[model samples]
Target: MKVYIETYGCALNKGDSYIMMTLLKESGHEIVENYSQADAIILNTCAVRLETEERMKQRIKELRKIGKKLVIAGCLVSSEPALVMNLAPESSLVGAQSVDKIVEAVESPTRRIFLEDSKELITPRVFEGKISIIPIADGCAGDCNFCITKLARKKLRSYPPRSIVNAVKEAITNGAVEIELTAQDTAAYGLDINYSLPELIKDVLEIEGNYMIRIGMMTPELAMKEIDDIIEIMKDRRVYKFLHLPVQSGDDRVLKLMNRKYTVDEYKQLIKEIRNKIPLVNITTDIIIGHPGEDEEAFNNTLGLIKELKFERIHLAMYSIRPNTKSALMPQVPDPVKKERMRIANKVYEDVAYSVHSEYIGSNSLVITTEYGKKGSIIGRTINYIPVIVKDYNKLGDWINVKITEASFFDLRGQLIQ
Candidate 1:
């Protein structure tokens, strides 16, 4: 069988697709690059937002026209299996937790659906680029009112630390220079088991390899729980000094409504502590605009927080009502208001990012070539994970010292400092 897997959403989805491809190949099936050249298509989907779900629906329609067998995987399989079936009636559904059964789904004659909470497996994966995305766990501890994902990924269950360590070891051996420890909330890792993320990192780092690990997004409440230990572990030279901590809102009233356990002050203090210890750490964050009960004052509070924090990167999202979530039932902010808030957030982020990134200009740093850039250039990353685009065709895993020549809100451009 020839299988072409298309992935959507976060790093976890990408990691799942890689595992599925590896499984298929190990079973003597071909993994085709183009969907038109394949006998089956697997869409590892994400329904974190309603907009993303709509896009997935359209893609299913397009793929259905290709006349190949379809397999739907990811959060949609558990949250709304009917959506997948309605979009492509003949499609088989495999939830994120059922990734290990992908081979059976492909070979079985019946329409397969697996959504049980089975033991998480870390199968051998074949990564496409220089970076490898390794999922530390499936699901999370948070029950945010606005999240439909919580329904799909029910309980927080950490994968065995040994399995994760082995996955990282194999990735490093396979020429992966960057490893991403991804999950719904990395801060909540190892809660179910009597283990911790720091312990897992220490074990993985013990492996003899030249690579860096990028920790995924963490909720503020859980971050504070093990923050001291996490900061100590991050001080290791092999870990990138980057933190993605999403502060959904700055207003206490709105946050309470959203079921976020932490206050704005606590989030600010965590940022302060981390920055004080790691002076050059790159702090990124996520913000959702016009969520339920976010009136003019609440939106102002968010803008104020963005100005105060001056995040290195901001993933701004407009609130969208999904099929079944607490926020979806609540009164929604008008579409026009959402659009306006997004504009303000974008402008504020642009100013902050430009100011912060401009300081990197004229600085010289060592960068690892990770991926290709637009228009005959190559993209690399500094120790802090800041992307530096240089005009060259460097090998994927090559490292070079470059002097920063340009800066922008999105990335930095540099010249090889030979």
Candidate 2:
């Protein structure tokens, strides 16, 4: 069977897709790049927000018209299986936890649904390029009122340290220079199994490889517990000096309503400690604008926090109500208000980001070429994971010195230096 797999959402979902493809191939099925060339189509969906959920629904409808054997996979299947079934009753369903059973769904003649919770975390043997995304754990410890993902992935399940280390070793051996360790909350890893994320990173670092590891998003409460160890491990040259701690809101009242575990002051102190230790660390964050209970003062507080912190990168999104979430039951913010707040927040982010990137101008830094960029340029990243686009260099995964020449809010442009 020729199977085409399309993945959406976070790095964890992409890692799951890779595992599914590997499993299918091991079962003697050919994986096709295009849906038109496949006998079956697997749509790995994401439903973190209502807008994303609607997009997934529309995508499923279109794929059904392709008339191929359609398989709905990922969080959408686990969180809203009925809606997916309603859209395409003939489609087979494979939940995020049941990724290893992809072959069964493809080969079985009868329509199938594999939504049962499983603790197994399968590692993929095949990786696509110099970058490998490895899911170290699944689910998270947080129960944020606005998060629908908690409904999909209900428990924390961290993979064995040996398995993750082996996976990282294999990826490096296969020419991968960058390994992304991802999870719903990476810092929450190993809490269920009595191990810790710092321990896992130490194990991976022991592997003999010339690669950089990019740790994924972490909840502030969990991260604060191991900040010392995390900072110590990040001092190694092999680990990227990047930390993603998402502070969804800035107002204490709003934070309480959203059920966030930490206070705004605590978040600020965490940032201060990290910066004091790793001054050059590129700290990225996420902010949801106009969530339930966010009024004019609350929105301004968020804006003020952004200005005060000056995040190197900000993933700003307007709050979208998800089905069955606590925030959805509360009084909702108006759409027009959300839009206006998002606009203001976006402008602030752009200005801050551009200023951050502009500081790199005229500086020489060592960067590892990772991927190709727009037109005839190749993109690389500094030790801090700041993207530097260089022209006339097609080599991937090679370390080179670059002199920063141009900057934008999105990325920086550099010239290869001898």
Candidate 3:
């Protein structure tokens, strides 16, 4: 069978798709590069926000018109199985936890829905390009008021250290130059299994490899609990000097309303500590513009915080009311108001981000080519994870020195120093 797999959402979802593709290939199915050529299409989806969920639904509708068999996987299966069945009644439904049964779902004439808790890990993945995404854990320990992901991915279930270590070793052995350790909350890993993220990193680093490991997003509260150990592990040269900790809001009141456990002050202090120890680290965060109870003052507070922190990257999004979440029951922010606040927040973020990136306009650094960019250009990342685009053709996974010639709000343009 010729299969086409499309993935959405976080790195974890992408990793799951990789595993599914590897499994399908091992089962004697050919993986097709084009959706039109596939005998069946598998959409690995996301439902973190209402917008994403709707987008995924629309995409399924689009794919259904092609007359090919469809398979639905990922969070959407657990979050809105009924709606999925309504949209594509003939499609096979394989939930996020049941990815191992993808072959059965595709081959079986009857519909298959696998929503049971799956503890299996260490699945083989087809590494693409120079990067390989490895999921260290699934789900998370948080119960944020507005999060539908908590319902989709329940509880913290960390993969065994031995399994994760073997996966990492396999990736590096297969010429993977960048390994991304992803989860819903990477710092909360091992809470259910008595393992720590630092310990996992130590085990991965012990493998003989010339690659760098990039840590995924972790909530500020959980990150704070393991700060000392995390910082120590980050000092290793094998790890990227980058941190992604979403602050969400800058006002304590808004944070409390969002059910965030940590205060804005605590978030700031964590950033301070990381910068003090790893002075050249790049810090990125997420900010929601109009969450419930975020009045003008709260919005302004978020703007103020972004200006002060000067985040290397800001994932600014408007609050989306998701079904079955606590925040949906509160007095919702007006859509117009959310749009206005989002505009102002976006301007603030661009200004602050451009200012931070401006400092790299004339620096020289060693970057590993990761992906292709626009107009035949190539994209690479510095040690701090700042994206650099060069026009010269370079082999993937090769380290090359480049001089920063220009800067954008989010990335840099570089010329290879020949």
Candidate 4:
């Protein structure tokens, strides 16, 4: 069978897709580069926002039109099975819990494989791929009020530490230059099993990988408990200095309303802790505008925090109510208000991001590669996940010095100082 698997959403899904790919190839299936040349089309879906869901729907429709065996996976199909089925009746759907069985589906995808978990639960941190994503945990353990993933991914399943370490080594062996350790909450990685995130990271760092490791998003609650120790492990050159912590709201009251379990002070402490340990670390975050109860005061508090933090990057999104979340039933903020807040937050992020890059106006940065740009300018990211453009391919997978020639609000234009 020739299988074409297309993935969407976050890094976690990317990891799942790779593992599934490995399994498919092992099962003697041909991995096709084009969907039109395949017997089946597996679309790894994302449903973080309305726009993302709409995009998946459109892509699924397009694939079905080509009349291939379509399998829809990821957060979107997992969360709303009936809705997805109605949209594409011929499609087979699998939830996040059953993601591991995607390989079996591919082997015999004429039948739907509702694979959420393996009875074995043997997740490896190292797999065979240069661009690899390995799961540290599954679902999440937090109880945020407005999150739909909580319902979609209902358990706190932590992978065995030994298995994870082995996977990391395998990926490095396969030429993986960027090893991403991802899950619903990577910082809460081993809490359910009495181990901790620091312990898991310790084992992973022991693996001999020439590439860098990326730690995924963590809530303030989990970060507070392990940040100090995590900071110590992150000092290793293999660990990237970027921290992605999502502060849904900056207002203390809104935090309470959202059941985030952390107040403004707690979130600030976590931020301060990371900054104190890793100087000039790329601190990025998530901000939701116009939640059901967010007022002007709450919005203002978030804006102020963004200004103060000057996050290397901010993922700004308008609050979109989901079917099962607690906030959906509360008094809803108007759509116009959400849009206005998102606009303002994006503005603050752009302004601060530009100012932050100015300090590097004359410094050298190490980067990878971006898909776009003309011959003279190629793009890549710094160790901390800061976007940079360097005009050289000799250093494509290897890190090289990029002398800053100019700085833009979103990226830096530079030349290889070598």
Give lDDT per model, in order: 0.88, 0.92, 0.89, 0.79
Candidate 3 structure quality by residue, lDDT tens digits, 1-418 = 9999999998989989988988899999999999989999999999988889989989999999998888999998877788899999988998877788889899987777778766466455677888989888888998899888888887677888888888888888889989999999999999998888988898888998789999999999999998998889889888999999999999999999999999999999999999999998999999988999999999889988999888999998899998889999999999999999999889888888899889998889899898888899999999999999999865788889999999989899999999
Score candidate 1 by lDDT.
0.88
Better candidate by TM-score, 1 or 2: 2
Best by lDDT: 2
Query: How displaced is residue 366 in candidate 1, in Å?
Result: 1.7
> What does the lDDT read for residue 291 in candidate 4?
86
| lDDT per residue as tens, model 4, 348-370 | 88899889988888887777653
**Largest TM-score belongs to which candidate?**
2
For model 3 the TM-score comes to 0.98
Q: In angstroms, how far off is 1's CA in candidate 4?
A: 0.4
A best-first ranking of the candidates according to their lDDT comes to 2, 3, 1, 4
What TM-score goes with each of the models?
A: 0.98, 0.99, 0.98, 0.93
Give a tens-digit lDDT track for model 1, residues 8-122. 9988788889889888999999999999899898989999898898898898899888877888888888799887888888888898788888988888887888778665476
Better of 2 and 3 by TM-score: 2
C-alpha RMSD by candidate, in order: 1.1, 0.8, 1.1, 2.2
Task: Give the poorly placed runs of model 3, Cα more than 4 Å off.
Answer: none
Per-residue accuracy of model 2 over 1-418 as CA lDDT, tens digit each: 9999998998999999989988998999998899989999999999998889989999999999989999999999988889999999999999888887788899989899999876478887677878999999989999999988998898889999999988898899999999999999999999999999999999999988689999999999999999999999999999999999999998999999999999999999999999999999999999999999999999999999999998999989899988878999999999999999999999999999999999999999999988988898999999999899999688999999999999998889999997
